[model samples]
Target: MSRVTPTTSRSIGQHTHDYAYYRTVLANHALPAAFIDLDHFAMNLERLRQRAGNLPIRLVTKSVRSVEMIRRILAAGSFMQGLLCYSAGEAAWLASQGFDDIVVAYPSVEPTDIRAVATQLRYGRAITLMVDSIEQVMKISRIAQAEDVVIPLAIDLDMSSAFPFIHFGVHRSPIHDETTALILARKIAEQPGVALQGLMGYEGQIAGLMDDVPGEPVKSAVIRHLKKKSIVEVNARRQAVVDALRKDGHTLRFVNGGGTGSFESTRQDRSVTELAAGSGLYAPTLFDHYRAFKVLPAAGFALPVTRVPKAGVVTCSGGGYIASGPMGKNRLPLPWLPAGCRLLANEAAGEVQTPVQHALSTSPATGDPILFRHAKAGELCERFNELLLIQDGQIIDTVRTYRGEGKSFF
Candidate 1:
């Protein structure tokens, strides 16, 4: 079934989703529950489409772990194509649930994991595995041949640019240059039971890092400058590899790049066929620092205030949904809503209890729901089994997360 887009030119976060707004909407709900504001979610969907321009977007499954949510986004428009699955086993599971055209984002050498994906190929599922090395390609090829099914594969390129004192990107794939990428792609073209389906170059520095952070003009400027330089090198390197492959008479099914943060820049590369984005759908706190586009905090958890520790402090029950990354303050969840509540410095979010400091005027009373946005996206789903779907100021429905569906692949 087709879905409707529910958004307008009006501001999404400035005045729409205030504390009082959700309080009345979720007054009857339980505490420590995750919820999606369908209105804002629709706006984000529109925002993603607009930013992507003509490029198709492959949803990153790691950022959105809910089956229902994924279905809704895919139904949002034809611009949404396929999924960049995090695990091979999970990709096969999604295939079992009737989703196709899945590409596993990471390479797994386990024979059992490869077989799980090969099993899906019998049904003609276009499930492509990611490989960055000849060994990875051979491992998958051996398993694919054993399964008696042809498996497709996408090559992951390391888009990081190295400088004197810094590595300006995340440490991901090891295939860093056109020669290295061609060597691997050539291996795939000659290998048995494995075909070169596409290439994916995740520019983590441009996609994952924030450049316009508040109160850090110098730092932000430095990041922006570094990103500009990295983009030129990244685009050049990616083009070189794509050109080399096509010159070798190999056809590419697709060329995927970037995250939501880098769409504006990534889309400009002629070598790119599509871009990947998912965190923008939910817009966690970590996504707040991007300059190109601002997405609303459409998804968050409401923790019921359990106690008033002081005149200006309220403690909520169970919120420690910290995102997986290098441990630091940025990985901590942001205390949203109530307008003035902030997590304590000494004790930010705790497993059993999270104490928040707030202005007296905006202080939350006991039993009141304290709204908080997670640092990351899909990881939040791992905490809550279900998400309360809110729309038109009412609880429209409740959707099960991947965890709720008895599927935890990580």
Candidate 2:
């Protein structure tokens, strides 16, 4: 497969035509009813690869739930680095699949998952467990010691705007400030069995926030301001904590930061050794709002047009698959192509059908494909059993998601 580039309005039309052919082929082959354009996916990956430059991107498995797709991308180029997993079970599963470098993004509360991490670590897998508090440390340590296992660990620092108030981003990690982060780092460093490998800071406001959109200018401005403040304050404070840890004789191996959206800015920071990226693999509608760079709409779901009540409204079968974030119309699946199509006010995305309002020049007949891209990437895969990999407007192969593989790690 050749490297694909980012799509514009011109190329997107061609992609649509290509998708029609791909889906038709799949239908003829008796395959499951889902499609993924590999050409677009490859282009999306390359777009991220070019944007990231020299910095290696840790594939966010949560964004791309298909293990085979992850493997396929990893095989694409060496620029792709390690897996940034969401769950401990995912890390363990990836480790079993011969993935050496794996970092569990969130702290694992499940004892069974922790034990699995310990087992993977015991067998010489480079799996890093993310910890935020001493309580978290104690919890994992107890399980580790009980299993007589020694493992590597990374401290998760809460990278959010903390100027006048704690009013931005997700309230994830407790280690936001230098003092608190250093204290936790010290505790982890003192732990005999576990090794403090590095620090992981996720700037969600800068990385995940949508900077561009048609309306909501004031909200977008606020998000941009928060992101600017966060980059300056968080970077300084995070560096301070790393310095403090080193000053106290801690040898930090790596400092991980950023996501797919903020790769360029994060890579400029000398403090961050490696940047995290996963969502770019399948550029969702939420990511479409960014102004800095453009990525291809790699992943999408086609729900069959099941209900058409009026000349202006057409409802599709099974489209209630919404992404987890602030709920609004933006969270709903966007109707791509044949422009002027929008989601209905009463029912945004229904369980069985989503009514869309559009001025179709030629009234769309029943069974006409309504391609909808979710606001977020991997979350969409969870709703589907398999992804149809399309190459050059053709269905080349079909791959199973974690759901299809019977591994619900989440």
User: Model 1 reaches what TM-score against the true structure?
Assistant: 0.97
What C-alpha lDDT do the candidate models reach, one value each? 0.89, 0.79
Cα error, residue 39 of model 2, in Å, equals 1.5
- The pairs that clash in candidate 2 are 4-43, 318-352
Q: Which prediction has the highest TM-score against the true structure?
A: 1
Judged by lDDT against the true structure, how good is candidate 1? 0.89
lDDT of candidate 1 over 1-410, digit per residue (tens): 23646455564444457898899998988887999988888888888888898999999999989888889889888999999999998999999889999988888787887898888899888899999999998888888888999899999988999988989998898898878888888889888999998999999899988889999999999999999999998988898888888998889999999998999989879999999999998989999987778888889999999999789999999999888999899999888898878999999999999999999888688899999999998999999899999988898889899999998886
RMSD of each: 1.5, 3.0
Off by over 4 Å in 2: 1-32
Worst 10 residues of 1 by lDDT: 6-15
Candidate 2: global Cα-lDDT? 0.79
